[model samples]
Target: MTSAAPTPHTLLTPGPTPIHPRAVQALTRDMLGHMDPVVFALNRDIQQGLRDMYGAAPDTFTALLAGTGSLGMEAGFANLVESGDEVIVCANGSFGHRMAEMAARYGARVRLVTAPLGEAIRPEDVAAQLDDHVRMVAVVHGETSTGVLNPVPEIAELLRGRDTLLTVDAVTTAGMEPFHMQAWGVDYAYTGAQKCLSAPPGLAPIAVSDRAFARFHARRSPTPLWYADLDGLRDYWVHQSYHHTVPVNLHYALHAALSAALEEGLEVRQARAAHIGQAVYHTLEPLGFRHYVQDPAQRLPTVLALRLPDGLNDAAVRAELRQREISVTGGLGATAGLIWRLGLMGESARPAPYRTLMLALEDILGVPGLAGRFTETLTEIEDAVPA
Candidate 1:
């Protein structure tokens, strides 16, 4: 007899996470005028929620761009870096390299401080690249490619009292973890709604400190890009001066997502992510799976990468999971086929998806006895999950 098929696929992939019900309902709302009072209220709440989630100071200028996470990266680089400016990019994974590329696009002289995959870049290594000429220091808070969570707080600390501005791609970390950008003195940080906020892709929420705004306004070059220009975005988001037609409908979904997150509270959301992460590590370690990331503490709770077990086919195992109606992804760049990335993000971080994943892994890894063990291991995780 065939095993029971796990129908109605559960999404367990990082980014573009399973959309929350509130977000889905949010999309069904009638569209409003961009300058409408209701929209302005939504814009205020979204911007405020972004500030609170990011740990931004009250004076920090925050806005949402109608694009994916990559566009936020471009806006951050373009607004700050100009011709002949020097920027330091901490490269530990694919996103870090993307930051360097973005800086180069703006004609900044980019210096890269890189580390091995699965290893977080050292603060000292980042400090080594610092000089008076370096105008900005960019790092990925959660390097999803390898599931390595960089030391953003320490890196932010290193830039303290220095002239170099700090920018972070918190695409995979922001709503799921404590970003601490204001406390860390980060000048600029950006996150997408898709990853941790449980929203569909499109809106990128960003926070920029007063100092960063000062630098942006002081730029020698006139803002070259119209759509993504921070100055125009600020005018629209802050003063309600029309920039372009603001995304009215996407705002509905994104606002509901952020509202759900705020309702859940950051501390609780973080704990939920941690609860799921512990269960994953607990199941994998005994099954003899090796972590791609060296330090467990440096691992991202939202995104986890593990080496594929010996004798297991990459496509076959993934296909098996797919047949079970579970959606997980593989590695990218140099780590492809060597590791698989499982996302425990937002609504996907809940126990049900993970229970299926664990069972699937047990079957795929040929551990028949793990069925009993999995049940025992998840009791603690189950207790913490909200009804």
Candidate 2:
């Protein structure tokens, strides 16, 4: 007997989040010439929206690339760090390690300040790594691998009054978390449209401070990567200089997504994320599960990392959940078999899906006491739901 394919459902992963209906419509709208006035207007609106979302200074230059979050990571490093420069890369998770790799690819001498997965980097440790030769200090604002939220504000304060420029990977925290680029003293920052922005995967929204741009201008050798070179891409995005053909439909979708974010208000969006995260913590703690990150303050509201039960097969548990038409991710890199990372991001960062997930998981794990607790929790959740 043939079983039908699992029913399609919403994305509960950290990135490529659930898209708004309006944004989906924008993607289906008639495509226009890349150089058309209408397309250019859409690009302008996206840039402005990005600037507002980042809380960038008025003079900061913002651009969008036809790539994912990794492209933005490469762009920021390729444009800023030249050969023989020293850079400090914070490595608390997979994404932070990627930054170090990109810097090394560009010929920079990369020094790593690493912590165990699920642990935040101490600002003093970052400061200790800084030296006269260090040109940049790069950190990830939200490490999706372990659900650890790095203290970017504290790290920024440590770099204050220093010659080293600060760069942040806010791919998972951009719209959902509080990221004030100018106020946080981040000279360069990059994020993906798919994550907190709740847009489809494609465009990377990036912002650069005046100081970071000056460094780019001062590079003795041209940045090697053409597709990501800020000096050239900035002209195309801001001046309409036409470096390459733009993605018209994606830009329209991004514009609509940004508009929705603004209408929801950043504060409200952040509060929603926090509320869902708290509920998840409360719901999961009594199920014989424990968080990977011991400190609540270091955990991100969008992603939660749980240590699997002793003797339980992580992959099999994930497969069982998949059978029930629910999906959650495992940890990355060294923590893969040891942890399960559940993302409560954007539209999926709500109570209903989480409650459903808890019920499904309780049935799968089938621990002695978890089923009863899960039943009680589901009843409480149902009672809380509006009529």
Candidate closest to the true structure, highest lDDT: 1
Per residue, candidate 1 scores C-alpha lDDT tens digits across 276-380 of 777777777775667888788888878878887786688888898988888889999898888888887789888788777877877786777554555567776
Off by over 4 Å in 1: 1-7, 361-366, 369-372, 381-387
* TM-score of each prediction: 0.94, 0.92
C-alpha positional error of residue 97 in candidate 1 after TM-score superposition, expressed in Å: 0.4
TM-score for predicted model 1 compared with the true structure: 0.94
Clashes of each: 0, 0
> Candidate 2 clashing pairs?
none
Worst 10 contiguous positions by lDDT, candidate 1: 368-377
Name the regions of candidate 2 deviating beyond 4 angstroms: 1-6, 366-387
Each candidate: RMSD? 3.3, 3.3
Predict model 2's lDDT versus the native. 0.83
- Which tens-of-lDDT digit does each residue in 1-387 have in candidate 2? 999986666456766677867889889999799889888788787778888899998867888888999999998888899989999999998999999999999988999999987899988898888877789999999998899999999989987788889999998888775679999899999999888878889999999999998898899999888988887787787788878887888888888988888778887788777666656666677655688999989988788788876877888988888877777788787888898777766777766677677667667766454435545655565567566
As a whole number from 0 to 100, the lDDT of residue 83 in candidate 2 is: 88
